[model samples]
Target chain A: MDILLEMLEKDARLTPEQIAIMTQKDEGDIKAAIDSYESRGVILGYKALVNWDKTEREYISAIIELKVTPQRDRGFEKIAEKIYNYPEVKSLYLMSGAYDFQVILEGKTLREVAQFVASKLAPIDGVISTATHFVLKKYKDNGCVFKVPEKDERINSI
Target chain B: MTDYSKKLSKTAQSISPSGIRKFFDILDDMDDVTSLTVGQPDFATPWHIREAAIDALSAGKTYYTSNAGLTPLREEISKYVKRRFSLDYGKDEIITTVGGSEAIDLAMRALIDPGDEVIIPVPSFVCYGPIARLAGGVPVYVDLDEKDGFTLTPEKLERAITPKTKLLVLPFPNNPTGSVMRLPELEKIADIIEKKDIFVLSDEIYAELTYKGRHVSIASLDGMRERTIIASGFSKAYAMTGWRLGYTLAPREISVQMLKIHQYAIMCAPTASQYAGIEALCAGDEDIEYMKAEYDRRRLYIVNCLRSAGFECYEPLGAFYVFPNISKYGLDSESFCSRLLYENKVAIVPGTAFGSCGEGFARISYAYSVKHISSAVEKLADFANKIKNERKL
Candidate 1:
């Protein structure tokens, strides 16, 4: 099972036959395991980690550090749910550091990202304060470089 | 008109042009051609390394320091080789050259005399044979078997050796095929080399790019260190191809001779690049790991795609290229590649460009983005189907 998950993690495009060959398991069994994993939510979904900065499309992402006032009954859960339910929120995490919550969100522009924080986020009940760190440049994200310089396309043999 | 053939050196006139250059000229004119032709890393030089070069230039550290390259750079290289590959050479034993290409040339020039035989395993890099010829040595070919993952076996080495055999070029983590020799494999080769009393030029430029386990240099084998000259560089690992910085680690006897050639033919490697190399050696381990993981991911993707498309791809353990056996399609490597280029708008290098043994195979590099590789593979599948259907008819 670990082997199947690892192979998929390395390359989601790997067919069950390829996995079977790699793990020396039956292709049908591999497929069944993958199906089970998906149904059980162990395998959520597959997505590409694209370097959008290479394209003409402008994408602005930010990691907003949030200090929230938790309700006595629900603790951080109720407020966290409200913040995460917003369309702009990409990922929400309960952090153990100085910040209580780390909310990773994205927008089309810097102003849009700022507006989401000021209008939607800051105005939420139990929201103590919000600090935003806009991604200026990404050297590497999710194990991919955004804009690697073009190397000489000539053959390097010899 | 003067017969320039008579004026030029015999060796220069005798050398054949690289087979790859022709396809490159054709590829240059074609539009929307997605290429997996070149054996270059698509990643840029990590920013910190590049920044160090920029900083050096800004500081006006432009003058050539010494013939053997800047001392600090040599020291860094010595430290790096020891740290990463577990091989030690004193600072003076290391000579930084203008890419691994120049280091190979320097070693060849230093070691080979007229009529000395140099054994080179193929289908490997193209340069080894030519460089061996340029040094007035006979380039003895030991064709690598696809069954053995293109690693040189003791039997092959023994067969290729002769009374006059002076050097054996060990090109593991190879170019066209991403074959890597593990420690046990290296030890076997080392034992044969030791018995034969020949020197080794281990080209480990792709050392940091190995996927399965860590790369083990043949020089690390006991008694082989004195007989091996390691040629590796920042180009492949740190993605600093344009920087033109590489180093050679050898015993003092060989280093002194190589240094003499380096001093005469090339005074020094570029100063700015030397500074960048220092930074790379000091803090480029993480970058190598990051890039290797990405390459490993892409390696699996490309190999799986090729296999699914009805090509037999030996799962490469290192390097970024996948040599898929295209023999099943009933076309030669060149014809298959050319047709793929012209008909399918995809460009891949013919395996014959590397050696005669590579006739029925093609080398596809996974250095491009996953999107690019996926599109190219689809086109390749289409090309394979067309050819197979045509064969059936």
Candidate 2:
């Protein structure tokens, strides 16, 4: 299952016939493997790589760290729900250590974040305090690095 | 069947979208991503400028002024331009619009026709191409090389020109890539435009934000005055983005057309904003100097940090962004930005978002607080080290 999943991840566009040829299995087996992966929710959805910087809409990003007291029964889920409700709140996660929740948000400017905190997140009952940290740089994410690979450097080289 | 949906114009539909927003959307979906993706200033609209707006509101200056903008504001802009860039224009020649953005749109609309080619140097501000298209012009994107500090040299400019070319959009103290074309560079471009009879739409929004040397307007050059339209505003210089006030300086014939467009399209810029703009132009020189000094500090810091982290960064001469060559990562800009946001929680705009030439580069804006800039650099260095280690596997 792991090998099949790995192969599919590498080439999600691979046809059943093609997979069958590579794995020396029947088309039915390849189709079944794909079906099982989708059924198990391993294969999500495909997306186009959009070049957003050229678009009309201005891209504004910030990372906000929140310190909150977990409510009874609901605890972090309730806080997370409250934070995620705003359309501007693109992502939210309960984090360990000094900060309780880390939120990733997008808006037109810094004032947008301030407004979100003032109007939406701050009023929530369990929220004790919040510290908003705007994002300044991103080097890598989701197995993609922003640097080009050199020809001389092999994968094994440190 | 009755048509229920409003039809968007083909021009509107065909508008090339901004690439900066994509990674921003992704970063928005992640938790704790540190980002230097913005292209604006970190400082607040200076106290005096804000106070001027407030004072105007308090004094019941809420009523709309002339479509060309307040007389005092236009006069101030006239003086400011002359004082700053040594460009001469009457108050009537300038029309205050909503940010330098509106100025660009107006210039294109006032001049360009359908099928007319608008030559734009690439890896520039995101608005030029789309705005050119909206004005019924075909955007002819010319990729500027990193070797020339991402500037459009005489050869590049002359080569990009065709008989169909009507307008040339020069975005300097450029965005994405922090390149500035000084007087010498401007002279080379002016010489070409003189021979070609092409109109120049110079976006000098970052005119006052230059770190080293002074900004020279193409209009200031010989024979270029009649053909050059200067687009600038108080947004970057005065940290007045929310105010949405800007102006253009052109020949009276062009200004007349631009005023007609402004009168119909926007009616007038915000009333208080015009008043604040007056204050920014007249009294905000000190504030501009202060902000530029701070930005210079952050700029140097980021450049050094990127260099130390094994990235090759062309020393940015103007603007607050540092475009670092990230080709060593073996990933494209999108993948690079996504991975950076997801794994290390550091977000920077991939250079490809600017244009095709921006591939294998990332634009990190230094228009942030020194503290944020330092911390982001630290986090980025860590991410670079991690990638270096991971490639070993």
Candidate 3:
């Protein structure tokens, strides 16, 4: 595994110099490698993982599963493009079972998400049905756990 | 209440309290201290292995196992030792211990007679000397040189041996020093042991964490198998310290003797832990590699950090600690550690806690995240500057 990518995935704020010392690499080489990774699209944008429940932010997120009928030649890709273009759509994945698409979306309120699902999502051609499930809590995401692990209760010992 | 002092065994009374005890109490009261004082792995037992124990509990495997252990666990342990270290031990030759502590105790009690001698390399773990004394054996400390990377050479071993020397406690990929004895080094020690009428208790708890090369067991060398009993556990290897699972592999005759002690004393290791041990030995190789790689990165990073701060640090070849030379700072190991804790809020173990020979050095554990290490090193560098400045006066 490329330790540079691994470190950046864990904490993108680490400077090239710090990564060089951690990985025992030349700082110049680290910077060059990172630059190439960024150019090659392997290095995506870095963002903070925030818990909105702990903040003053007012929003609700929902997973809207849509059953789609594939257009004769276009298949599910055309429907995926139409759903993902909306500003409220945070993430979308083509599904394997029971449903044709899984759409993770955010809206200002429960009513907003329901309205989008009912009026906007349901009216789309080749979309058979929709089910929206609200996310009540997030214990973990992207390998970053939200719960502060039980404070290391280990006593100092041999 | 019962006049315990007068009635207690003299050897037990002679053992002093740990030197690190006071600092630990103070650390508990003080918040926001980034301490590198832990001797166990920082990672939790991987979840799948824990789930196996949960399954075992659900299945009601609650009865006491055989005196040695569950047959399946012993078989797994036997297969594991053979697969990893190339030391073949049948299921009949292994005994499940409460922890490596109990296994070491078992080895000491089963082998040492009254007034027999046990050769111990100093600056190792704190348990052996006291355990030997409790078993009515004399503890002979062999001080290893820091310049030698704290390895016990053949000459050192030879000098420590005596007519009554009945046992040698060989702990390597050592805890405080992190010095691992490779095959060639083991070969030298084996040559000397081949001549002597002595037994060996090889404590290899940190065997899987050898970063430089594979760890060589003395038991694997020629003619040493019958004489060496390997004491190891799941604590260091699989991060299962809280589970209290360990085992010992010995020659058939010696194992029979050790099993008698374990059967009488412990009855058996925790039944659920034995079940978990089976899962760990069979499925935890990837966990070992993953944790070892994490330690290796922190090892390199912490060594670089300590060296850059102007401390004379020994680059450890194994284990998760960096034993740095702090004698030049005009303070003893305890003083250096306390000053660093109070002044800089970074807590590392003084080397002397391992043995008197660990004086003038401190063991900094790298079993932590890189972020934690870097933050602590930042304060340590500041503290080093303060010491250097004061010395100029």
Q: Could you give candidate 3's per-residue lDDT for residues A33-112 as a string of tens digits?
A: 99899999999788998878788889899999999899999898899899999999999999898998999999989999
Q: Give the C-alpha interface root-mean-square deviation per candidate.
A: 4.7, 23.2, 1.2
Candidates by lDDT, descending order? 3, 1, 2
What's the C-alpha lDDT at position B203 in model 2?
A: 93
Which TM-score value belongs to model 1? 0.81
* Model 2 agreement with the true structure over B1-393: per-residue lDDT tens digits: 655335657667666566566556665566555568766776778878899889999999988899999999888888888898888999999999998889999999999989999999989878888888888899999999888888898998888999999999999989879899988889999989989999999999998878768887888999999999999988889888778989999999999999999999999999999988888888888999878876775676678667877888989988888999887877788788778878778878888888888999988888765556668888888877787787761
Docking quality category of candidate 1 according to DockQ thresholds = acceptable
lDDT of 1 by residue, B27-145 (tens): 88888887887678888789999999999999999998698888888888888888888898998899999999999998899889999999999999899999999899999999998
Listed in order, the DockQ scores are 0.24, 0.01, 0.69
Give the candidates in order of TM-score, highest first. Answer: 3, 1, 2
State the lDDT of candidate 3 residue by residue for B1-393, as single tens digits.
Answer: 799999998888998877778888998898889888888889999998999999999999899999999999999998888889999999999999999999999999999999999999989999999899999999999998888889998999999999999998898999898888888888988888879978899999999999878888999999999999999999999999999999999999999999999988899999999888999988999999999988998898999989998988877988898999988888888888999999899999988999889999998888888888999989988987899889972
Model 2 alpha-carbon drift over 4 Å, by segment: A1-158, B1-6
Q: In angstroms, how far off is A133's CA in candidate 1? A: 12
User: Number of the top candidate by DockQ?
Assistant: 3
Model 2: per-residue Cα lDDT over A75-116, one tens digit each: 788878877988898778888889898888888777887788
Interface RMSD of 2: 23.2
Q: Give the TM-score of candidate 2.
A: 0.70
What's every prediction's RMSD, in angstroms? 4.8, 21.1, 1.8
